[model samples]
Target: MAAALDIKGLKVSYGNIQALRGVDLTVEEGEIVTLIGANGAGKSTLMNTVAGLVRTREGAIHHYEEDITGMDTRELVKRGIILAPEGRQIFPDLSVKDNLLMGGYLRSDKENDETMKTVFELFPILEERQNQMGLTLSGGEQQMLAIGRALMAGPKLLLLDEPSLGLAPIIVSNLFKLIKRIRDMGVTILLVEQNARIALKTADRAYVLESGRIVAADRADVLLKSDLIEKSYLGKS
Candidate 1:
């Protein structure tokens, strides 16, 4: 079977600085794959490149065996590759429902309503605050709104960048639970997270990035026990 997402020899740069260097990775269908790295390690660059937000200097990205490298963001969305970007990026002026609706703008009203029902099921809090403006929600609530909005797009593959950023520990825990639920619901996930321990625990597979290259790839559980991973990312001596 074709992998849900695949990248080969991926390279990205910003003017004089290269963000990703010959990165190769794959996420099988219905799997949760996490990319863990420190600050400026090109995790977000990989996510953005996959989502078509950043142009690649060299590499190929494929979705279900189809070449989609450098595709337009809207085209990628239409193909069921959706990105819930970093920082939640919710529209402060829009109501919770409106923010979600914006995510489904590509679909018909009927389709959006149907997808919204699923999103509400995954995030009941969003249903409770459907009429509230985005800025009124707490950090955790905003994060839920962001993921909920992405679900509103009926994603086949979800690219989540730093979903746990700025959330309390309990909320991060809950968020990972929801992420697992999302994977169970058959959405392939490519996650970029700074919280290595939690991310490794949640993912089926893990990739460690340093200075724009993958230094290690393994099962999440294995990486969690790795001494190098423990010392560098997991804060274990």
Candidate 2:
């Protein structure tokens, strides 16, 4: 089977500062692949580049065997490449339902009911607060709203950036559980996470990035036990 997402020698830059330097990785279908790194390690940059929010300076991005390098973000969305960005970038003034509706903007109302139903089932609170302004929700609720909104797009490949950021430990645990649930539902995931421990724990495969390049790649379980990973990211020797 082909990879759900494949990136080859992917490089990106902002002015003269390079964000990604020949990064290569792949996410197979029906897998949760995590990219773990420090703040400036270029994980988020790679996500945005894949999502078409950032233009690449070199290399290629392929989704399901088709070359999609430099595809427009809107075009990428139409192709089932959906991104729930690092920050919960929901429409603050819109009602929760409206925000979700925006995610399905490419679809007609008649086609989105089932997707909405799935989103609601995954997040019952979304149904309870359907009419509430997005800004009124707490942090965890906002994060749920963000993921629900992405689900509304009927994504084949989901790119989640920092889904655990800023939440409490318990909330983060619950959030990762939901992420695994999402994968079980058949949407392939490419996750970029700063919380390396949970990221490693939840992913099927993991990549460690450093200074804009991939330094290590392995099965999540194996990577979790490595002395380098334990000391560097897991805070133990």
Question: Model 2 off-target regions past 4 Å?
Answer: none
Best by lDDT: 1
Model 1's alpha-carbon lDDT is 0.95
lDDT of 2 by residue, 22-134 (tens): 99999999999999998899998999999998999999999987999999989999999999999899999999999999999999897688889999998999999999999
**Residue by residue across 1-237, what tens digits does model 1's lDDT show?**
989999999999999999999999999999999999999999999999999999989989999879999999999999999999999999999999999999999999999989899999989999999999999999999999999999989899999999999999999999999999999988999999999999999999999999999999999999999998999998844
Global lDDT scores for all candidate models: 0.95, 0.93
Error of 2 at 23 (Å): 0.3
What would the TM-scores of all predictions be? 0.98, 0.98
